[model samples]
Target: MLKNSLNWIKKYKIHFIVWALFMLYETVVIGLLFNLYGNPIIYIAHYIVIVSIFYVHANFILAWALRDKTNVIWRLPFIIIIQIILYILLNYSADLILIGLNLIEVKGKHNLDSTFILRNLYRGIYFLGFSTGYYFLSNFLSQRKKTEELEKEKLEKVIQQQKTEQELIIAQNAFLKAQINPHFLFNTLDFIYHKVNMHSEIAGEAVIRLSQMMRYAIDSDEMENTIYLADEIEQVENLIYLYQIRKTNDLNVYFSYTEDVKHLQLIPLVLLTLVENIFKHGDISDDDDIAYINLSILNELLQIQTVNLINHHKVKNTTNSGLNNIHKRLCYAYGNEVSFQYQSIDQHFKANIEIPVKLLKLPI
Candidate 1:
């Protein structure tokens, strides 16, 4: 406790010295006004008792009292009464010290008295007012400083938030560019495969087919809405060839397309998604199940059909999911000009799609 008090005094040493100097100046001014000089020690003792009482009540007692939530307004009476008691005690102690030190002339009979009580009471109000005003002003300035700091922090947070959002947009654009560059990447792969073809024909051929499929994906997603029908068919063919190499060699997968595709323009990836969905959901291992893919032109309308035995339930999940994506994209491109039919019968799933080229509306 003594250490804490010493630390506190050290922290406020400047305040204490300044206040003491102010009291001393007031004392000297009062001596000049009265045109009389008492021993400086007597005045020093006098103001010590008075200033200590009032400043203690103001700085320490009231600081604690006011921050309390309950009975705060009612604390005025209690605080005043405590200060009055302190004032009486401090004055009485000063008088005794004066007489003991022979600092003041003792002209009266030796009778301890409360004769100074009324005068001190009158002085208490002025001292209390000064202390109260100082306390309130200090509190207001402290609160203003805190409010300013809070506003500064909020402003910094806003600026940081904006910077973060800008970084996110840049990252998103970079990600889209990376996603849309597969065509360039696949072309590089094709170049590498051609250079290696002199060493290994089978490896070079497989690499080229994979390159074609990757290029198809990049072109379908990043280029114009409509692509040549031949491009889409070639992607389906590459995908099937890659699958045949990876899957069982004895797998019976049939693919047929009419010659009309050479002159037609079709929505990109329509044929590829259909063929991929078949491989993804079909029972290719069972020799008894049938799987077929066909594309034809009838009455100036391009038609595509796929049938596969459904073993997807045991290995992959493919219940109309691929169909949904195709349906949504085709509907957006061709609207009611597109016809789609899908069904499951006798452990087999079939999908048929037809679109009239004459009734299409192309995006600008």
Candidate 2:
């Protein structure tokens, strides 16, 4: 009951304000009329009762008028006519009682005539005006509320769709990266087979290193995001060994740790991509033109620097797909915390990458 009352108040606050104004008008009329001739206390009491009756009448009329009962055309006219008759009858009965009690005088110098029919006509017009205004106002407010709800729902749907698309893109990129290691493995194995058939003694060592590299890749592939830095370094070392056996000249691989990394981790093969790029693009066949890779942690930063002798005389074709993939991975992993750059100078191709050491130290 209390909830319903509160809801009604909220829905009809303006109507209540109008009714309050009418009550105040009635009170003022009674006060002035009483001060002029009758006792003020009696006049106030009589008008209070009259205002209470008017309030109940107005409330009931409005309730029935607004209700979705039958056809509005039939219901509205019936409600208005019935309420007019009821109001006229009640007011006339009260007026008669007041006259009999001598609380109101309708004779000589002080008179209050019972004009029931004329009062009813005026009251009916008042109710008609109020009801018409209320109907349009309520409809406008309700439609505005509905439009706001629809806009909220549309925005929510758009946000959900964008979230789904972003997830799909992340999944697709992961799938593509997953394909890379296997393809690299197949090519390396083919090279190993050719070396063995040619009776190269280094083929045996290459097979051992390849086996370890394959084991690390397969093990790390099961992880969705990251692996320990120690494990990643181990895999890179094995790949470097394999690359050394395949290349005719010297290629140097160096790894250093300035900070404890038993707890450090990174996405698998992040550094390996840079290493692979070097082998693919840099000249490793000349002793004087050695390829060098250095990885270290210092000042809470993981630094990876690679300098390779660039054979400008040879055909230079480097696809950006691998770098783009790494860029995406770094963005997803470190956001703005990681920095990457590559430069080509007089005879050397260089890449320098710095990633926050805190990322590496996080427990995977």
Candidate 3:
């Protein structure tokens, strides 16, 4: 509170000084106009008393009266009562000072006039009215300045929020691009090592297919946002083939898709993640543990389904990671238009996803 008062004083100090000077000039003008310049004692005494009373009334007494305008019953009457008390006090004190100095005369050429009583009453009320006007003007300007500050602060917050979101998007894209490099290179190297030793020529074939899959992923990140239905299915086939040679143990994996898709475009890397999840978590050792993947274009709708026997005892479940990434990417790209549903029941886990693919341009 003290700091705020100091700040307000600093801000209005020049105005206060200028107004004081104007008051003194008005006093001098009134004296000259009345030809009362010869009575220095009377005029000078009035200058000190009037200036002191108006200053306190404007800054202190009026401030209290206006503090709660809602309580008119008490505050309004309080203002009137205080002004009455101050008027009586000022008159009584001025009389004592003038009489003590032998400046006032009751029965002589310098006797006080009855008209002077009316004039002093008029001056007191007149100064109070002016002081009230200045108080309201100061209040209006303070409110305007506060409102401008709040609006400017709100705008700055919104701009900062937008800037942070943009930066996060750029970082997410970079992180996703980095995700592909290590996994692809390691798989390619493993396949190449087996092929170079001549222990398995089939592994060399897997290496060629892995390179093709990587090319598709990298190209999709660079050149195009969507690819043909056939292109996606071909890459899924290569991913499955790579996994088949990857594990020493036998695996049960199956895929089915219609060949009648005349026009289909899809976001890349979606189907590959599902197949990777199956190999990582599905129970392939059991002859009955089959990982079934289905894809079809029916009436312009593209559907991908994966069903597998979940290895309940496995410590790590790779399906959650793959599905989470797919969900985030799908929502970012397709919003709510794409349908994706997945759940686990007992030992079996099922996922079905559908997207509108017939809207794409016809394949060349």
Candidate 4:
């Protein structure tokens, strides 16, 4: 509460300073010049009422009256007349209370004469005019500050856009310098495959499978953020085949999926990552203990699950960053609608991912 009070005071420090200086001038300099010095209590009480009127008039009365520009001319004047009448009545009441309390001594009986009425009328209008001016000036300053802020934001956005464009241009140039033409690479691979087929058909097929996986990986960067689920599944198949050929068909793993999922779409590389993890960490060489990967659509969700026996003989040298990255990407793409989880059960490691597929973009 004290901190908030300090903040409020700091925010309105200029207003406080102006009111203080004005009160000092009225109580000291004017009193010295006119020789009309009186009770300190009277000065303090009247000044309090006057300052309250100033703020109430500017912040409330004028704010409401001018809120709608239409019909403001008559609305403002009528409210001000009512305010002045209240001010005059308050003045009389303040004087009566002061006299009853013996806070001030009265020299003569008070009368509502022309001079007295006119003097108070003039005083009320004088403060009203100052308050009105302050209201407009405050509004002008506030609008100017908002305009400056909007311009600053627009400039920042423009600068950021230009920086991004420059970085993209640099990246494109670097890629062009480093990239080998896809057509040439594929032609060379095909030539090698044909030559290898003359001696060993299995080796030639492996080369072709590797070439296809390479093409998928390279083409993936040029594609959109997501591809047809069928495409990724095909790549996963090729990946498994390559691993099986490497192990001379000794690896024991199964990939199962529904045909309905062929038309559905998903971000690439996720399924491949799961399967690669199995090969990297799981003991898939045991035919009696086969690893499992299942893909299906159930209750408007696409689910991918994998279960494999842990290879305790292999060195457990991994940071699990691939699974972490997959989780982050899935969450980014699907918000709370996607889930990825992995844990060890007994001697087997299991991982499962589910993503809501109701809004998937279908290919034409």
Top-scoring candidate (lDDT): 4
Tens-place lDDT digits, model 4, residues 1-364: 9999999999999989999889888888878999878788887777777788889998999999998899798999999999898777777778777888788787787666687678778888999899999899989999999999999989986875465445434433533543677666666667666766665676677667777877888898888888898998998999999889868799999999999888888887889899999999899989899999999999988889999999977627778888999999888777887889999899999999987777566431
Clashing pairs in 4: none
Q: Can you rank all candidates by TM-score, best first?
A: 4, 1, 3, 2
Model 3 C-alpha lDDT per residue in residues 69-95, reported as the tens digit of each score: 787669866775667557646765776
Give candidate 4 misplaced runs (Cα > 4 Å). Answer: 180-229, 232-364
Error of 4 at 66 (Å): 1.5
Residue 238 C-alpha lDDT in model 3: 90
Model 1 alpha-carbon drift over 4 Å, by segment: 1-184, 191-199, 312-316, 360-364
Best by TM-score: 4
- Arranged by lDDT, best first: 4, 1, 3, 2
Please give, for residues 1-364, the per-residue lDDT of candidate 1 as tens digits: 9999999999989878978788778777878999767787877786777678667876787887778868778787788788877776776677778888887777775344556777767677667777788778878999999999999989977876465445434433443565646545554565656654554565467667766676677656678878877788788888877777656366668889888665677777778888887787778777777588898878878788999888747535445766898999888888887899888888888889988857433442
TM-score, structure 3 vs. true: 0.44
Give the 10-residue window scoring lowest on summed lDDT in candidate 3: 163-172
Clashes of each: 0, 1, 0, 0
As a TM-score, model 2 comes out at 0.42
Candidate 3 at 303: error in angstroms? 1.1
Off by over 4 Å in 2: 1-201, 252-263, 313-315
Task: Name model 3 segments beyond 4 Å from true.
Answer: 1-199, 315-319, 360-364
Q: Candidate 4, residue 223: CA error in Å?
A: 17
